[model samples]
Target: MPSSSATATVTTNVFEAGKYTTVLQKVESRTTCCPANTSPPPPVPPPKPLLIVMPCEAGEFPLLVFLHGYLLYNSFYSQLLQHIASHGFIVIAPQLYLVAGQDSSDENKSVTATTNWLSEGLHHLLPPHVKPNLSKLGLAGHSRGGKTAFASALEKAATTLKFSALIGVDPVDGMDKGKQTTPPVLTYVPHSFDLDMAVMVIGSGLGELKKNPLFPPCAPNGVNHKDFFKECKGPASYFVVKDYGHLDMLDDDTEGIRGKSYILSVQEWEVQGADEEIYRRSCGCIYESILGR
Candidate 1:
């Protein structure tokens, strides 16, 4: 069981180094050949934004929503999304805001991000079947987005949504005025079995989320993600990738971040870690936990 006093957070590869693929890259674009005098039509604003709906076999699918970390936009988290969607669950990663620089300390924006994600799902964009099964929904986020995931849960609980589970990817809790304490109050940590699901977290080298009071250790040297799983309440697992920084989890390649922190300098070419593998296994745990093997 996770200690009642505080929850654990891992932020290692949550923002480490790597070249994350873009969402636009996964989207199929239909190029229209225009006549020499023809002009492109004005872009139409969609009432409901498209949630990348990747499907697997004809079975009933569980909803998996992801919130990306700070500095990295939602579109850049495609590698992680594709990996999870491949495991048989439909996934949605909404681009809340694009965090591009250092010194991230915005709480209002964080709150808004959560609200937007909830709105995106509850909007008319979803299939009628997906709208009613709140019991089959799972919410996951990385870095600042992870904290936003918590906020999103609170919003949904107060409204017409009730998620099946919550997973934070090295989520950021530091900027929320110590709201990490809010989970034990609003969250009823799902059962180890019942489509009740689990909230297993994933981290890398420094396997813990920063800005979370529940996470007493931000970056534990040589932290073993497997060891943390023993303390986890889910019928799931925790993971710490070897030789990875925070951004590696995404597909973005880091050139200047190496100078920001010594830990961010590990080269993917020389490292032995698999960020995608860890992400796949973690999300897969969510998939299996929700739908059962």
Candidate 2:
């Protein structure tokens, strides 16, 4: 098991020599410090498709859908999506929970419905300034959402959505039943899916969930990223951020875990220092794959 105290020493330059923050720069007046607010959210008229973030720029930009982890709201990833938008991409995040109840199988359908909405209904719903390129699309998620991303990519053949790239961040496969197989999360993992597009999995070296001092560590060793990387076919990239915890990818306090760093000497701010770097590297790959660069 990797020690929580282990510090990241080997830092390979993820960015190319000439390309430095040229694509993804933090937007001014809109820092990552912005809070997540689902109240007064974007209108989700009939058919009930959750709409999170849509860029104001009107053009044929690649559309990237971010799936929120179980029990987490879509607003939690606003900063991440906005960072991608800054780099010229159209991001759409949908709330995948059902007020009645939720199941692992629900995510696949949620993604499919959202994709259908994007291709058929988005133009009628959004303002005239918002334009999305449905042809070039990508799927990304965190935790259970990450598993959902994998599922969606694998099941893309059933939907009209054509995903060119897929990304998973610290994705976890959910619990399993004795024999029943109602929900897919019970046995789902990246390796279970057949992906044709370029793939990337971003994992945390410190799998412990120390954000809450009271809660025990829940992340399983190797199951999150290593297993996924090992299962990936064709060309793929895996990045493990040393000392970073499960929820460190979110904005400063979106999850209240950022205030309490898992490591004693390192503060939460320090653990999150590599988040932007990770986003840049992943988005760079997505952009390249979508545009065929």
Candidate 3:
């Protein structure tokens, strides 16, 4: 874990460099996440819920940690979450309750604690016959949640926990270095996040990307994927879907006639020209690299 004046520890990984094999194929025995061998320290994955839906065959599956945006609940992301879960990996989505008078510091602590507990608690939940070891694991979040995940990675307390990749669905804030602190070190990390697989899907909300106040303005023309992905740095790459509004990711909203769609609030959206396939591909890519099968 690399620590700076403000070290952001997104230490989500616990597995060391080892042979590629399935936990489901071997005797089931997973107890704790490996300790950090680096500076600062990794941020412990939060504990919320881990729902696993395996593929037909049993092998080591990848993990995609889902994080919803602010003022939102994990339940809201159910469609996307379940879609990812059905793809044969473990899905961990930590709920961050935003109540009145909640302090950001306290709330973040809760987030980190929950993430830690979840990472450590995985092996115990498996049935004797089912051992879940994610070959590749990562995080994907939207709106403020996306920003939180992106910024959170920069501050992971543990210097050793590296995610395969990070997906920011039209992230806002944090990316902009401010007077308070410099942009985090995630932009400079190696491919340690992913053992073998790596893919970063960056989405710009049609509503915001068109004329986003936080992200680059995407009005008349549109914001480019590079604008957002460039900030991530490292072996990280990106993807952006046009025409889709921010709320399209949610099943609740109806698509617009032209390039518009009923908003799912100021967050979450379906990518332009992308039906549900984007979700499937998102899971597919992450799944492919994590397991190394």
Give the best candidate by TM-score.
2
Where is model 3 more than 4 Å wrong at Cα? 1-58, 100-107, 159-161, 174-201, 209-227, 252-293
Candidate 2 local lDDT, residue 107: 71
* TM per candidate: 0.52, 0.68, 0.57
TM-score of 1: 0.52
lDDT of 2 by residue, 107-135 (tens): 77878877766776556555466567788
Of candidates 3 and 1, the better by TM-score: 3
Residue range 128-182, candidate 3, lDDT tens digits: 4545554366766675566456555555563234566667665544323331112
- Flag the better candidate by TM-score, 2 or 3: 2
Tens-place lDDT per residue, model 1, 106-196, is 4334434433445443433334443323456777777556656655554553434467676666554542322333232112223322223
Q: Which stretches of candidate 1 lie over 4 Å from their true place?
A: 1-51, 56-59, 99-133, 154-156, 175-197, 207-237, 252-287, 290-293
| Model 3, CA-based lDDT | 0.45
lDDT of prediction 1: 0.45
